[model samples]
Target chain A: MGKEKRELTGAEIFWECLIREGVEVIFGYPGGYTLPIYDALTKYQDKVRHVLTRHEQGATHMADGFARASGKVGVAMATSGPGATNMITGLATAMMDSSPIVCITGQVPTNVIGTDAFQETDITGATLPVTKHSYLVSDIRDLAHSIREAFYIARTGRPGPVLIDIPKDVQNAKTEFVYPTSPIVLPGYHPPRRATGEQVSRALEMINEAKRPVILAGHGVLISGTANQIRELAEKGNIPVATTLLGIGSIPDQHPLNLGMMGMHGKAQANHAVQNADLLIACGMRFDDRVIGKVSTYSPKSKKIHIDIDAVELNKNIKVDLAINADLAVVLRQIIPGVRVRKHAHWTRKIKEWIKDADRRDILNKKTDVLIGAQVINKIWEGTEGKAVVVSDVGQNQMIEAQYYGHDEPHTHITSGGLGTMGFGLPAAIGTSFAVKDREIWVVVGDGGIQMTISELATAVQENANIKIAIINNGYLGMVRQWQQLFYNARYVETPIYSPDFVKVAEAYRMPGYRVDKIEDIIPTMRKAQAHQGPVLIEFVVEKHDTVYPMVPAGEPLHEMVRRPHVPSDAKEN
Target chain B: MQHTIIALVEDKPGVLNRIVSLFRRRNYNIKSLAVGPCETPGVSRLTIVTDENDSIRQNLVCNNLLKLINVIEVEDVTNVPTVIRENVLIKVQVNAQNREELKNIAKERNARIVDEGERSMILEVTESVGKIQATIDVLRPYGILEIVRSGKIAITRGDDRPEIKNGVAGRGTESSRATEQVNNYLY
Candidate 1:
């Protein structure tokens, strides 16, 4: 048969584009408005696997996990109104971490769009800020193009979530489908390329001229696949590398230059090194307030060389002496060759000294009465032998894990960085296990954030994803409380959180669980959790009012760090 | 003297209250606003049109809008022939004496009478700036019992879609085209 010019519905065309885009699976649920798309999926069942989630939120989180693990565009489908709204939190989480995800939602019929009919919602309006981009396809002819654009936007540049809300009438209308062979043509979207020669030269000059230079890496290093290059740069320049919470695995925690995560819950040495540096090379990081702490006082002794793909981030928070707008990978490739192998023995010794001092000041020593968050994370990491995908919810536990866990690979340490999204751990862990079924996935969450989306435990049970959950239950919004302690004159405000019996909640979901009040029970319970065939929840009733020290107060410069109240000298004397 | 203001706000309960509270708190007059979804989910967009000139509006967008977590992106689209519209529903006091006159006025303004009662009339108007204002003026004499107006929602005209590229409409003159191209590639 000759290539027949046959008309197809928008929903069909959208599916056809997905096939061309090499989509292997989609997590979603069917609804009244989205039935047409589900109908199309029936024909493409062999090529695309569709996992029906218990709720739209679960479906989106599953897609996000799939994207992070597979390094491909994750797709989720939902119907209009509440279904679309349900996916909002998941979408925001992916956006903050720059995870690539494509969300397809069905809208009410075009004619009844503004009428607020049954199951009708303005999803395009609802998801605008959280998505990297969104499309409201009003015409059948635009379906193929819109779908193509959605995937393209999702996977390209600083990858993030994109939404395509297709009105029911548009899905039903017929039009000739012609899948674009090339990339979608968008007029406004452009990601920076590798830094130019001049930029590389300036960076190299700054590196050579500085007495003490430090590399502050964020998640961008992994996203850009420049971890090896970063190591090379660090090794050649003999520069110490400090990471943000999301940047945990960008460099191995065991590396000599690695100073661990820097922030409220950062190590004393890492925080001190950042403050004392003469020049700071910040890569693929947005200078989150947690890292810079009191921006005005941060790194007062240093000149910042800010390198990021997004230009708006250059001088956004911490001003820079040299700004390079380029993809981390591309810029790293250029700088690798230009970097000279020079030893900063004096600087290296200073960092080493700080590390030794920090080790002595370990708050979680077996003798301590208080259950230290760091000790729990270290024990869990040791027990898992670095085999599990560690997903952390935002707060003190997240910071502690970032400091303690030895992440050796990309996508292994998953946490919300840019958005600092709470209630992200459980769902993300659920999604991660779905992506890597054979591997162990552990979700490290705080009491406050976990409660926000604890409902996702039901999703885990339904999916039969055997993820291990560790709740660092401190009976408060740990991160907010830390800030209030440091910046708000210890007003405490509403940071205190009262929670239900997490063990009972887990049992209700048919998941085995344990509560560990004593530090001694942590390792045994974690081991028991790991051995379980299905999902398990291990709650650690940590001490309340335990501040994550070495805090860089909000608006304070990075250098002026607040050392832990009990310094190494004080601890040694005791 | 036209200004474009964009706002990024949290997508949560009572967000509108927080936004309304902001306007009330600042006492800055908002002439028109277009709010919708942004590139991410669980976030809302607010595009404000104000009488304040470019510099002052820029300060509001940067300082006021950017400062709010619920408020995300603020841009001034006044020069771009943006498609701005508002939905207004007015319940007017109407009796047999003025019913015909009110109907004639609604017809002239292309407004529809959604519901009617013996003593009250609910008139709905979905229109551009001038027509919406004109319709509101005509109803003032009849005594509007209750009037509800949605903030302006807008999109730039002529296929300059922001969704296709991240920085298309927002970038200033110097690197607008380049920024759009880069955004397209990255997206």
Candidate 2:
């Protein structure tokens, strides 16, 4: 391919490499520093579509959402200095959530890099703590290779964001455009893929020996496309599955063995099962503080076996009895063969006994005068038949959505799990729209998180994304208010925030809208959203003081959850 | 316990910053760090010594350092059979009567009086860590005007480390990395 030795500017080669990498859409806001690449973009517009985001942070989030939904590497770009700096939060969010994203930032010319020229920022340096890997291109010849390597690194081995900072000089410099088709060898960067045979054997033995084995499924199951494998293993080994928040749809919510999300705001039954389990097999999920509160005392009865792609994750937080550093798919395939086909009927019965107060436990069953967030989400779940891709924002609304939304498919629930960034829902839903054009997309956000990224509505309008946004519009920042109510004397310091007329905001975007202050109108508004052909926003005015229950406050033991207010003795009949 | 880690990284902008950032992120306080070009033109060696005990913790740092894209190799040569050297420049106040005496001490220790002023004498010494410590101890009695010492840089006591390979061998991509084709050749 190089015999002809075709000469091209770095700008042209950059576009070529992107096209080769199967990048159909790029989300970014352009600037002077990246003018060369944008100027070269004119020729590649037909092959690659550029989505102009209102904020650089939104661009990164969109890329993250795209990658999360599509299972492909997402790309975001921005210019130097603030333009690059703005992508920091999104990068961190993707890094924590293990989203594969390639962020390209244009830098000041090489001659002026260290001198801090106008619009110059050491983006590579600033993002080193956040990104999986970063590259600063000094020479034009390295541009193609850097991008190729960046993509490879970003998409592989506990995938996370990788940044490529290209100086404007390098973009304009002439070079023989050699887009390396050959895989770049990174000897030091090999993620330990081949599972240690001894570890796998030991894991199998532990699985067979245990009376109550539980699978703590994490985001890795979805990332590695091992949902089926995990389900098969759980069934064969008679292990109950409890997922982390990011592991939402790894298995169907209705699956007999699925115990929903397990964490601070997880279901009571899931947390209870985990706390009581004898053998805990962690698949792709790190025992983060949020999940395993008080690591020293968390699940003390369990013999832990952690299987992850990154070796760094194991023994970093909680040391397991047996550790297998391999892809979830690889580890599961090997272990499934050796796993005994055993049924723990007594354990399943014990788990069922752990489930209490069905009506009181469910958010929808509460007899409340004010419209509730959970009731609205449950109605939407019914309206979409658990088929819509639900992208939730941070706070009370995100937790409520997780609890209420029933998903039948993996990658259906996309939210900022690690960073828990607010304002992630709307733009991310827009990205999910692009990913699965046919599937109905729903953005579940609180009154607080929505306003942070309200500008992305215009981008969604421009894209004509067929998305339905349900704002759980409580007058205050619900989660913070809940915390204040629980811990403090309910001082409500700067917690009760006011919001603009969200229905008007939706109409202003030329989208359809509705307001549901009444409980009876909740299902009607959801029906209208599901029936609408284009983007729609429904403002569901929820109870301001309502709090998410079964609350294991941060750093508290998983079993030490604050249950909901007392229920009537005949509440189960309701 | 202080552990010395040697890392070889691609000589590119922000590589040093990346290494420093990793140390900060991992909450490892850097005691001293010195870096310079290694035998490879495009590669540089970084000598980073940090206060750390557990061998497992040291191994974790090495693994993380090697995980960086530009980082080619990382070796915790703290306990290895190695030569650790440090250079020092000491300036001491001098007088006519003590000039000969100072020279006698300098000769005893293989240190050279690089610059000798009638009022002051500047001495330069490059020695193993132990020797440098001994020299500093011997010279401190004359009331050192000022002394500057470079951080310890270590190398294993062997013929040499292997030559730096240009491309990653384990990267599973296309098999088109033609061995006959010179990778660094200009168009």
Candidate 3:
């Protein structure tokens, strides 16, 4: 207790506050401005561990991945100027996904802040839109509270990333550190944890009256830890459950009533169920344009009920009949008791008919000599038994993973859904490696995305992170190429990209690497990579001209998706 | 439809920038805005008037403003019974012939000539936005040298509103009784 009376430097206070916030690890890189904090880290080495990432962007994504996988606030740190700016894309990705991450950046000395001195930048101003909240700490006394507030705001209601940019002068200044034990009282921030009884009753009434009900589960179900509650409601009411891309594992894929993802590249049956349902219960999801295509005709027959933690998301996209702004699990807990066990045999049969040829349309059944991205993903799924924490990068590979990799557990399928940032998978998988110990972790990235943050392989090797990366090497920016091929008269300009020998790159990082072009080699390469003691990479040479199927063109109705040509029966677009 | 929104925020540096940045980022149109110290020692009040008619977007903007950690409370007073005012200063070029005419115009519009110089006279007026615009329009013929207007500020009427304490109070009621008391004493 006498130690508390002694004054602490701001650098010590920064680490002290983080320790008080229950932070065990930080993903960061050090520079001139952060030298003092790094020195302070030497003092608290045993209490807190720092992972030295190759780049600040990778650090941010690693923090984001940690947050998404473990449901705890992830921490990332960096120096000023370029370092802070590099974290923008990752911060934006976390913002769009509602991941809880605390990003700390060391700023230039207070005297030189606005002089545009060496490595100085107005990061707080630049990151205002991307962060849920941010603090620029100039005073020594405010450092602890600013960090405390940052963690509180970042982890509370509808969690997202928050940043604290600490000037070097503040880090060196001395102050008596008092970690505030009183609960944070921000008069402006009140995250509702429970829905009003009347709203819950109204939702139940709408649920009970509809003959066809489809519950659209989203990432909030995972964040709120309500997958079981969601399944309970769906099963009790005989409702089919559809999910947005980020909502992949809200309901177990093997469950009888679980319809697959519903969005731009969602399954045909999932989209059809949403379009034809009489009551659509959207839980913990914002109605992104990708989810509700052609908003004017989206679920014309459904009396929609939207339940989300963020109030702004309730009516931001599709206007609903009842909007309940509260925690999804709490709201479902309220409504579950009153849910009537109703029979929808005819509606179920209709959905079954819609799903009859889904398996046939899957790329696995195709007798293709050339490897396709979907087939490779399916093979990886078989190799991992679909239990690995799979982080997918954006583009056609992302869609292929979502389609073929069935996640039966919540928080197993993580992707950058809203911002759709490339280069997210590798560092993010590394992040999950630290979060859940002894579990298999995988990063499914495309040839293009993997190259974007490919340098993180060094960080992976340095951390000795047990992560296996599957690069779906299509030799082109496959998604954009698909768009150009279908919409721009097959103009292939600038889409085909050149990649170095990925196996050599992996070898350069001192890890085992494999390249698989033939279909028969896919599983063996996966086994070899999985057997390695540390990080490994497998470059999958897929067909150059394959496309993701069941794609709803931009702004098209969800039900009118383009089906794959090889499907036996439902090849015709509805 | 125009909404008169009042927000109570922490009195700190860059708070206004945060609000303005939020409005700009969200694409919310602000017709006029004003901020000043309130009864609270560490709290400031912001009066924002938006002409956008989409209630859904307005609600979203209000909710977003509320999300700012510095922002304490936000109320859309568009439909509330409130007393609204704007302060305007109009500088007009005056000559021997038009001086008397300008005086008559200012008198009729309930505006006072606060400063009379050799080249021009400045008319000071505190009125509703529509009245202030009308007063400026009438003085325009005398060759308006310059004009500046304080954006609209509004406070809800009646005693049911929150009472002003040492450092915080309900946004709309803090100044209503003070304004009424000053007006009654002046009359």
Instruction: Specify the highest-lDDT model's number.
Output: 3
Ranking by lDDT: 3, 2, 1
lDDT of 1 by residue, A86-119 (tens): 9998899898888999999999998898898998
lDDT of 3 at A395: 98
Q: How good is the docking of model 1, as DockQ?
A: 0.05
Tens-digit per-residue lDDT, B55-126, candidate 3:
889878887887787887788778778899999898999988788888898899999999999889999999
TM-score of 3: 0.94
Residue-level lDDT tens digits of model 2 in A157-253: 7889999999999999998876676657664465545565677778888999999889999999898888898899988888899999998888899
Question: lDDT per residue, candidate 2, B1-187, as tens digits?
Answer: 9998888888877788888888888888898888999787988888899998776677678767866767877777777787888888999988988999999999989999999987999988899878988888988888799988888898888796733222221211211121222222010
Q: How big is the positional error of residue A301 in model 1, measured in Å on the Cα after superposition? A: 3.0
TM-score of chain A of each: 0.92, 0.98, 0.98
Model 2, residue pairs in steric clash: A185-B168
Q: Which model scores highest in DockQ? A: 2
- Candidate 2 regions exceeding 4 Å error are A1-4, A114-116, A357-360, B39-41, B53-59, B78-83, B107-131, B156-187
- TM-score, structure 2 vs. true: 0.92
Instruction: Indicate the residue-level lDDT of A381 in model 1.
Output: 83
Which regions in candidate 3 have their CA more than 4 angstroms from the true location? A1-3, A566-574, B97-101, B162-187
| Per-candidate count of clashing residue pairs (backbone under 3 Å) | 53, 1, 1
DockQ of each: 0.05, 0.21, 0.19
* lDDT (tens digit, per residue) of candidate 3 on A494-549: 99999999999999999998999888898887888888878999988999999898
lDDT (10s digit) by residue, model 1, range B114-172: 99999999999998867888888889989989988887777777865543222223222
